[model samples]
Target: MILQNKERIVIIGFGPVAASLVEGLLPAVTAGTIELIVVSSEKHLAYNRVLLAELAVGATRAEHLGMVDETRLRNAGVVLQLGRTVKRVDRSRRQVLLEDADPLSYDRLVFATGARPTIPALNGLNFDPHSEAQLPHGVLALRTLEDAMNLNKVLQGNGRVLVLGGGVLGIEAALAMAEAGHRPVLIHHGPAPLGRVVDADGGTLLIRSLRAAGVEVISEARATGIQKDETGFTGLVTQTHGIIEGAALVLSTGVRARTELASSCGLAVNRGIKTNEYLAADIEHRIFAIGDCAEVAGQAPVGLLAPGWAQAGWLAQYMLSTPAPGPADPSLHDPISLAPPSLESSDVLMLKGQGLELTAGGDIAAGLWDESGSQVTVFADPAEGKYLKMVSQAGVLTGFLAMGLPRTSAELVLSYERGSMLPADRSTLLRLDDPGILEPAGAPGPDDQLCRCSGATHGQVAHAVEAGCTTVAEVGESCRAGTGCGGCRAVIEAMLKTPVPA
Candidate 1:
């Protein structure tokens, strides 16, 4: 007897987070255990938003940005609905109200609402939040493919551009525009560029790197208003300084969790939709939230894509391992733990940008430093535009900054993620292009997670290799590593190059 009928699963949003969710549900979906309905507000097919910068500068085309192909969805029997907004979520009826269609009922609801770009509330900048507009010509935000398409038009001209905000997104935008042969000036509110991740000294090095790439980094300035004309956004006006003229303005101000839909339905709300470690919404155990829009209270949201993928895996396990309830099931009175048994401990950030390599996370901040217990070491070479910071706690590695150090950036990311103890002579770890000395240096440890995007471990990849997978593509096909974000492609290639010890 069927313990429970196939679950009617409805997933809202189709970004990386939602894609990860689909990856997790693929097994069940293919097994005829669940009916998947993915509803996204984006009109286009699911695509990787991380590479929008490349699309803007003419490096990559639109066809390459897509994340999901229709053939795969059709084979898996997934109902992929795009360009539709969920106006209302009725928790009582377990239904979602769409703007141009009928209600989508679900036995389980996944709120992967993701985030929306922050359209700065500057004077003369008018954006109606209720409706999605084509973003009048000239004004741009590097958040979506449509914005990137419009930006491509702006990049075709040899005109100067003004970029607001100095975070990772802003930096990438400025660099891309500069590479496109346009003069790009970056205005950051902080004392230096990339203030949040890098300290004053590290940020100084970042500015130099940006400058070397033809980007003008303006520090300690704030944009009070924006100037507009009949054409659209014209330029930016600073607080004290005079107007900064530009042919167009690109706002990479950052993003906020989209919580209106969940909040309107009487779900618990915090900085994002409140979900437990298992990603189950507090409103109902069956209702789950993930990605940039969901966070556990007292813990900062893992705005990056890795945590969302991890949560998707955890939810998949929760669904598979738990016994399905039969008729007269007491599931309503008793709920199950949906969070992963043990999520990855250390925070990891390996930002993606061509020519500019920077990986900072896992207690890399100065505030996490304590003279009595931690060692903060730094080295910078202006000639090579490289900066490295290794924060060690009680004789073990904690966090680091590997900016412009191309060779060891991926190594440092993996080491930090693994929480492996630093070797006695860790100065070698700071040395560029040298593994120097590691407690276990030859190959990735069996327990180490090699790809954060796919949560594939070293052992898994090695097993695939042992099974005659000689190429990165073969390994990705064998174990599904390097399939998300494409940041780990280099790491996978490095693994292929390293010989197995006899």
Candidate 2:
């Protein structure tokens, strides 16, 4: 892992995790130890994939989603190859053949190849994706910024949209289309749209919220096929509900890890490229992988951004020196292997769109708690669009979910993550209006985070305020607390109101 002067370190993808790795590797490159080459198959520079739905909804333009500054990247002596897809990887020769350009050589290759959208074998989407597949006239998958731009173009025609799949992206896309004055029908096979994320109560209330925001949700309807008439693609043909007519279709099915190039080069790949604790694939020691595409066997590939970011941080640090103690080459013969990629973790999902404000995570239903013999607490007020459910085992808050209560959701997420003990009177936890009744036993420790989006802790935000950050905007400029999704602005303002410790 020792990087010699001018070491050619070629990263395959330019997604968020790879950008993070490059950001970490930037400081070390001052001595010219590594020659960095980032090859992106995408035509445009790397943008925030998570906020592309917002782009489609016209909340923000495409220019706002940029992850890295091109001028700064150029100043760091980094080479960016846009619109270049790797046609093949020659492992023995240490070179990558490009489709549009000549081959490029690398001393050590890193695969940050991210995931691609999973289109079901439905009548509309099933086809060979590699051989210039043509989807139905107006059907598209909201995978990249380019896709978002195409969706916006469709929106301009004031076309009625038939959004397939009931995942997060599907909901957001439908809501965006609805906001742009198009009536979009949301069809889901499950009884509740987000049954996996929310409980029965939360799901009901979510339906209410969506309806109030002018979104039409059709539950328990499985689409059998996409019908096309003489005009073109008509709409969705469901088994039970019959045809739901619309002008266009957008599919938001989940994604699979993009591991085609890795598999082509004789590397072991299951759902993702197999790796060990250090994230070195079973191939060469210098050859490594990270992000959504890399999987430590026995563990499913983490499709979320946080775990991939953690993996990149570790892999970037691990690749700076000599290899870890073990056989540099883990055998590819064993496909179902296990690597301790990270610590035990949980993800907080925020329903992101123009008007949908909901956050859910962990075991979030009474039925789930009953199976584990854990105590369950519940609070439901559908009229006000609030639902709170908590799961406790041996006096520790194990899992919890709060909807329509931003403050409670943020605090509950912290409590679950820190494994905090619940108060003796558990019922008071849902008292959102009376902050005194629901307050924790003590103030957060200095290391405790006040804003997860910006990685600002109590100490950091407090110090920034103490250094004369008088307003939320000023604080955001100083520490980036309220700048992201604006979900943590309330917490930041409250922190600013208190006597911040040095």
Candidate 3:
């Protein structure tokens, strides 16, 4: 299919980044400057994958996970081909061949194919590379909605739910299952879960909290094979130990970027589709990539959602400036430059569930005996499942990890993000965990991030409120302050209840 006059832009993959890009380009599409066609292999609309585990445990609904306005997209004259797979890219004719559909030609093509779950090789489990192979009956990866549904069904069964991997997803899955009254055993090959981010002592505290929450953690164990009986799956055979019995298995072993299409079409493929700072896969051919599929030069695809969203927004603006794929339209206001957006910033990871509060960010590898002259403070209470470590350089908070201390962690996160100097009495920070101790009456500054998930700030929320948004839900709809993870909902509520700073 071809169109005359209008620039036809075809985007493959409809994940969060793709959805954001489509949202960003709707104005141009409505202006008749561009026509957007999105092809997605999944049947459902773009949804929040971060809440998949909660959905699996029946804690959240599918409607709550939606990330896009489908009605708005359809009304904007965007063509959405859901549950369809692209067969190949015929670059010579600038057309994409789809299975069971006519070839769709494009002036520009974007590959947002996203990433796939990494399935570990084990006995009794087989995966096909050429096709989208389904895992065996009792085994699944907690990556997609289908996998979450399967996991929910597996959780309804009697036997133990074995979770393999020690990443954030694996830990969250295990904890969720345990809370839902299912027997969950988390097996990891490392000394403990989150070894990369958490030190050995911090890992010990995390293990204690998991155990207290009724999750059986098996550390330093590698699953070598899968044991099966007349039933689908019986257990996982390990190298260090014998067979660890379980009814179903969840593989939370991370993800690999989808680069099959880019590689087949002659795009430089490394960890992902190699692109320059401008997110162009092949600028000469007008082919570009973003999200998990695009490996920007000198940097691998980050697993975080913030960077991907930033890239989508940046690329969308860039595309809007250059509607016909040549030099940027000089008449366009604020035409995007060839320079890439700055994405270098500290990443904060917060895990709160099952009576556990853990917050970690930035370089927390500082030790007690460090001669680097960085001020490092350590506090530990293993019996109570509490540990706190703060690393500061030149009195500025650099990195910190707080488990079982929510209030202190909150202060640490604010200080770290703001690059503020720590107070003279560091012991006073520990008093924040007390319920009676109230925070000073003042809201975060305009630039301070109120919602880490969406990266919404106090100024943005205030603007939304001033624009007549009275409630938390209205603020979320207006500025996306509480839309992601719902971690910032309380703060948004508090801000709405009181007058924000000017």
Candidate 4:
């Protein structure tokens, strides 16, 4: 049913969100109702940015990072303009000006430019976002495949890798580097790594785990300037640690939404490209934004893939359902109005690595001395590299942070999501890590969330496995589990080995 008048959709940026969007819209694409054009500045096709750390450590290959099949996309009549940049947008003409290329007209324009690494402003480092300023030699950010390749080169040598920032990526990078037989020195200004997500007690256990994994932890140390010579980057000069020698510096500081194109085109720009609940940029023409670049309802993108994937799927369906405005009637906005589901915040944080396992969710900052009605329980054994804190409100698990206990963390996450009441005795929950201890009722049910990122439940994964999905990757392809963050991979594997009872 190829229509003569096909709605032209131009999507800029081909990341995970864009990949998901294309997958969702494949049916419509095959039906020939709409024509799709994907443009990206990166030369490579869409790949999983979540596994950059694993790639850097040589644990995963570049081919494994691909999110979409280019051949399939091309076969579906998708016009992919790779390694191309959209320099300008003409709202009146409904055309996007490209760099060294002809202007591309579109019936609907989607901004999926995602985000860029937040290069820290340090002495001896001049990174101008507006200009093409290169980072100093021996310094990098593990955000892309190119960065991973460069970082891998540095890790191959016998010098200490200075990892600045103690966020999830930073920790993963440091641990991966250490696992790959490289020296890594983790420097953070806070009392411990993951300070924003985990409390002090949990942080202490994390620091211990890092040390056990051969990563040197330098806490409360703020890096002020870069230490470099004619050869290359020597190390970093910290306010507390003074001069810390290293072969390369990996900045996992943060990320900022790439909103330059949106801002230049008179679109509302806050921390990201501003959009309404329907992912519309409030323009008369069909202009929408999603992924890490879209800031909807004053909520900025947190650099998480789950929310972006959700937006991508929703936007794809929305575009398909709504009728496009007539060519002559430019001012007539489509009457279709269905608000997208609210994006969930990163309440659940899990750090999975060798010699380290932690999961924290909700507000676990409530102290034991608090006179509040919430019951706070703390279990700490520094010698054993274990810690657990649960904040229960009226017997329901409100908040929790666990370390060195994978089983307990999994159970806690299940309970947290369910809002289920904790056992009368807290020790019973702690004993989950004990050998040969069967789950005392209230275990992971069929409906329990197995993959938080994909919203895939235990039963969903079980069904996928029963349908002949043998491996984790197969299950992921079937049910979209273990695709984001890779935190729930272990559980998915466990389920595959031991069938979940109906």
The lDDT for every candidate, in the order shown, is 0.75, 0.73, 0.83, 0.85
The model with the greatest lDDT is 4
Of 3 and 4, the candidate ranking higher by TM-score: 4
Worst 10 residues of 1 by lDDT: 323-332
Per-residue lDDT tens digits for candidate 1, residues 348-415, read 66655546788887666654446557877777786777788888777666878878775566666666
TM-score of 3: 0.93
| Colliding residue pairs in candidate 3 | none
Q: How would you encode candidate 3's per-residue C-alpha lDDT over 1-502 as one tens digit per residue? A: 5567788999999998898789889999999888999999999999888888888888888888888888989998999999998989987778999998999999889999988888787877665443454677788887788888888887776568999999888998888888888789999999989988899899988998999998999999978989877767888999897899988899888878899988888889988899878787875638888888889875888776667777888888888876555434222244355678656645788887899889998888878898998889988888777889999999998888899987788888888888888887787888887789877322368988888766778889988987878998789777667776777888888778887556
Q: Which residues of candidate 2, in runs, are more than 4 Å off? A: 1-5, 127-134, 179-181, 229-232, 322-344, 352-356, 365-372, 435-444, 449-486, 489-502
Off by over 4 Å in 1: 1-4, 126-136, 282-284, 321-331, 334-346, 351-355, 362-373, 407-415, 418-426, 430-443, 468-474, 477-480, 497-502
Number of the candidate with higher TM-score, 2 or 3: 3
In order of TM-score, best first, we have 4, 3, 1, 2
- Score every model by TM-score: 0.86, 0.85, 0.93, 0.94
Give each prediction's root-mean-square deviation over alpha carbons: 3.9, 4.7, 3.1, 2.4
lDDT of 2 by residue, 313-354 (tens): 666675565432233444333332334446334566777454
Residue 371 C-alpha lDDT in model 4: 87
Angstrom error at residue 276, model 2: 0.6
Model 2 C-alpha lDDT versus the unseen true structure: 0.73
